[model samples]
Target chain A: MFKELIGKRSAPSKNVIERGAVKKFAEAINDPAPIYIDEKAGKASRYGRNIAPPTFPITLEYGAIEELVLPTKGLIHGEQKFHYKRPLFVGEEVYGVTEIKNYYERTGSFGKMGFLVIERQGTDAQGELIFTEEQIIIINEAARKGMPV
Target chain B: MTAMTEIKVGESLEQMQMPPVTRLDLIKYAGASGDFNPIHTIDEEATNAGLPGIIAHGMWTMGNLAKLFTPYVEDGFIEDYAIRFRNMVFIDDVLTLQAVLYKEEENKREFKVAVVNQKGQEVVNGTVVFRMYEVGMAG
Candidate 1:
C-alpha cells in the first residue's frame, strides 16, 4: 500500500556556536583536531574561523519536535544528498527549512509498498546562501525487508 | 545547548553542532550504518586512500540529523525527496542539519522544503512536498 502526506514547516531561526563548542562536539564524535578547537589552526586551514563539522545542524533536529510521529515498522533510508555555498563559522547564526516531498508505491514481497522523501534547506546569519539536503525514509514492507542492502 | 525553537518558513535554524573528525567515531558509525566499506570502517584502507583516517557512513550522519527533526509532524511524512552526497563525513566530525520552507499553503494543503549543513554545505539538496490538515481539522 502507498500513502502520501505533505507537510508545511516554517523556517527556523539563526543559531551560533563558539570555537570551543565546535571542538567539544567534535570530541563527542571522537574527532582529534586543532582547527575545530584552535583559532590559529582554523585560520591556517580553509576555514578562517573555527568551523562546525558538516553534520553540526543535525544536533538540533529533534529539539524542534513536540511529538513523535513517523512510519516506524518498515522505514529505512532510501537516499540522501548535500550541497553547499560556504563553510560555517564559529559564531554565525544558522537557519533551515524542511518539507515532506513525495512518495509512491510499487510491487514488493509482503504486498504493495510505499516510500517517502523529505527535503531541508539551511542558511547562515548574513543571509548568505548555505546548503540544501534531501533525504528519504522508506515505509514499505517489501523495500524494508526484501530489498537488497 | 541553545534554546531549540519551532521551525517555520522564512525563519532559520541556528547553532547546529559540527564537531571534529576522528577514528573511533568512524568505527562507531561503521557499526551504526552497517556499511563497513573498509575505507570508513578501517584505518588501513582510509590511510592508503590518502585520507587522514577512517571516514563515516554518510547516512549515519544524516540519520543523526533526522533525529533532530524527530516526531515528523503530519507535514513531515511523505510525498518525495532526494539527496546527493557532496563530501565525505569522516569519523569524529560532529555535523549539523538545517532545513527551510520554500512553499506552503494551509487552506489547500501543500509545502516545499530544503536542507543544508553548518559549513553552509548542501549535504543533501532536495525538496519535500506533503499534504496537510486544514485549520480546524482534527487528528
Candidate 2:
C-alpha cells in the first residue's frame, strides 16, 4: 500500500508581509490578542511587533492549490501542533519553500486512499528560518471496482 | 494578480518563528479552535487524555508549521502542506523546524522536512509542494 506512492519537490515563495493581511488573518482566527493589530498594543505585549496568528499565511505562503492537492473525500481537518520560537508580527517580509515529502496507499473506512504529506518553511527577510509546517492530506482512490494486484 | 504569478522549484525564502511555546499559547489555540477538550488547559484533562500533562493542540503545532510559508514570490507560497500529529510537545519543548532541498523535477514536486522538539524528538513529519502556476485556474 505504501509502495505506489513516491516523492516530489518544489520551489520557495516570497512575501513582503503586509501588516494588514496579518490583521485579517488574526480576525479569521478570532484572536482577541491585541499584539496582532495595534503597534502600541503590541509594544505592551511580549512580541513588540504586531503579531500574526499562526496558520495565517499558509494558503498565501504556498502559491497554488495544486501544491497541496491530493483529491479525496471526507477531507477533514485532522490535527495540528505548534512550536513558536518568537511571535510572528505584521509587516515583516518573509519567504519560504513548499515541497511534497512522501505518500502511500492505506485502507480506511472510506477504502483505499493515498496519504501524502507536504512541508513549508518561512524565513524572515534577514534569511532566518522562522516557521516550518508539514501538512498531511489523504486522497481517496477513485472507484475501479476490480483493479488491483 | 500577475504579481502572484507563480513560484518554481529550488527557490527559497523565510519568515519568523513564534517566540516560544507556552501554556498560554495552548489556551489561546484552544479558544481559536473551540477544542476546549480540557487536556490543553488542565493537567487533569491531559492525564485523562493519556498525555503527560497539559498538552497543546495538535492543530496549534500544524498552524505554526503553516506560518512558515507566508513568504513566497508574488504569486508565490505554499500550494498546500500537511502532517500527521505524531508526538506531543510540552511547555518546555523548544522547537526547530526546517526543510532542506530533498528532491525536485519530478512530475510531482516534493521535499523532505521535519519539526523537532527540544529533546530532538520528531514531533511532526510531513512535506510541502509548490506550484509556480496552478494547472487549472480560471481568470
Candidate 3:
C-alpha cells in the first residue's frame, strides 16, 4: 500500500530541547527524577545542567514530508526500539530525519493488514548521532481501504 | 545508597504495581507530550476508529517502566530499550511491571521486562540494557 513511500528519506529537521518542555514531559510521564527538573540538583550532577528523560526525544515534532505521508485513520504503533549514544541534555539543539525502512502486508486474525517500519535518527548540533528510534506501525484492512488519493 | 554489590543472571528484580490508568491521566499525558492523537483521549472518536474505546499511548507505558528504575539508575543511564505492544490497554487497567536480570557483563546488565494486565495478559514486552556504574544497583 505504501510502495511509493518505501526507501524515501525525509529532510533533516532541527529542534532545540527547552528545559521547561523537558520538565513538562517528565511530569507528564510521571517521572520525578531531579535531573529532569531540579536546577540545583542538575548543577551538582555530572552533566552540570538539566537533562531530559531517556525517551524524551519521542516528543520532537519534525515537519512531515509529503513523500512519506501515510494514511493514519487506523494506524497503531506495534513495536518500537530506542538506542542512544548518550542522554539528550536540555538546551541542546538536535536534528533528526525520518526514513521509511520497510513495508509489507500480511493476513492475521484481524484480517489483512499493512506493516510499515520507520527509522528516525537524531543528531546533535555538531552532527553526531545521539539516538535512533525504530517504529513499526500496523494499518488495519479497514484503514487501508480508506486511503486518500 | 547502592543496593547490590554482586549481580547474577536469571535473578528476579523487584516487582511493582501501578494505579489503574484513568482517562484523566491520558489527557494530561497528551497535553504534556504534545501528542493530541484522539485515540488517546476522545472515546467517541476511538470507538469510531474501531478501538475498544480510548487507549493509552504506548509511550506512556514504556515511560512507566523507566520510572521503576529511577532510584537505581543515573539520570541518563539507559543505553537501549525496546518494546512490543502485545495488546491494547483500556482505562481502569491496573498494570503490573516485572523485570528479570537476563544477562550481565562488565559494567553492563540486561533486563527483560513484562507489563501484564490484572487478567495476566501481557500488554507489553521489552528488554532494557543499562550501563551500571556499580554492581547490585537493584535491591
Candidate 4:
C-alpha cells in the first residue's frame, strides 16, 4: 500500500514555533528546564532566548505531512531518529515537509506486517534546514485482516 | 556544559528513571506532541485497533530517554539522538533510562542508551552523540 509514496514529498506546511506551545510541550514531558520556558534564564544562556525541547518538533504535525495520509489504525511507531543542525528556538517561523523514505514487509510473532519509513524536514523562513525527523511506522496486516488478535 | 575535559570514554553516566507511564501522561503527551492518535490515549480505541490497551507515544518514550542527558550537559546541547522502539509500554509501567559513554573521537562522545520497563523488558534502545564544547563556546 505504501509503494506509491516512496520518494514523494508533501507540500511544505508553515508554522510559527510559539513560546506557549514550547511551554506546553515542556510541561507535558515533565521537563522543567528553565531554558525551555523561562525567558530570563534563556537570555542568560548561550541561546539568548527561550528554546523548545529537543523533541518539540514532533508537535508540528500540521506543519509537516500536509498531504501524506497513511493508515492510522493498527500502526505502531517502529523507530525514530532526530538530526539537528541546532536547537529550534521560540519565535521562529519554520516550514516542514514529509517525505516517504522506504517501505517493506516483515513477519513477526503477531503475523505479517508492513514497515513504512517517513522523514520530516523543518526549515526556517529563509529556507535553511533546521532539523529532520525520520520515523518508522509498522502496520499490522494480520489485525487488519481480521485474524486472531 | 559537561566540562570538555571531564568526559571520559568507558565511563557510565548517572542512570535515571521516569515516573510510571500513566494514562494521564499519554493524554498530556498527545496534547503536547500534536499526535493525538487514538491508540495513544483511549483504551477502547486501542482495543478496537487490536492492541492490549492504550500505549504511550513513542516520542514520549524517546523523550524520556533524551531527558537523561539534560542534567549532564548545558541546556539544548543535545546534537543528535536516535532510538528504536522495541516493545510497547503500557500504563503503570515505570521505565528506567540509562546511558554509558562507549566511544570518543577528537571532541564528540558516543553513548549507548536504553530504556527498560519494571519487569526489565527492553522498551527502547538507541545511541546519543554529543560533541562537548569548550565552556562559553556554545551558541
Best by lDDT: 3
DockQ of candidate 2 compared with the true complex: 0.07
lDDT of 4: 0.80
Whole-model lDDT, model 3: 0.82
Model 3, range A20-115, lDDT digits (tens) per residue?
Answer: 888888887778789888999878887788778877878885556577656768788899899988778889998989888899999999889899
Maximum-TM-score candidate: 3
Query: Model 3, which residues run further than 4 Å from truth?
Result: A147-149, B1-5, B133-139
Cα TM-score per model: 0.46, 0.46, 0.91, 0.89
* Model 1 lDDT tens row, A59-84: 43312322225542344455765544
For model 2, what is the error of residue A28's alpha carbon versus the real structure, in angstroms, after optimal superposition? 2.3
Candidate 4 to native Cα RMSD, angstroms: 3.0
TM-score of chain B, candidate 2?
Answer: 0.75
Each model's DockQ?
A: 0.07, 0.07, 0.60, 0.66
What C-alpha lDDT, on a 0 to 100 scale, does residue B88 get in candidate 3? 88
Give the Cα lDDT of each candidate: 0.51, 0.56, 0.82, 0.80
> What is the lDDT for A35 in model 1?
49
Tens-place lDDT digits, model 2, residues A1-149: 32333344455677766666666545433343565677787676544566676566453554443434432223333443233344455777777666666676678887786666666667787878777766666555652222221
TM-score of predicted structure 4, chain A = 0.90
Q: Per-residue lDDT of B12-72 in model 3, one digit per residue for the tens?
A: 5677888899998899889878889899999998887778799999988887777666655
Scored against the true structure, residue A143 in model 3 reaches a CA lDDT of: 74
Report lDDT (Cα) of residue B63, candidate 1.
42
Tell me the tens digit of each residue's lDDT in model 2 across B15-108: 2334567787877666555566676788876675456887666666766655444333222234445566668778867776655444554323
What digit string (tens of lDDT, one per residue) describes model 4 on residues A1-149?
Answer: 57777888878888899998889888888786888888998798777887788788888853434345655466678888888887788999889888899989888797789888989999999989999999898888854564544
Candidate 4 clashing pairs? none
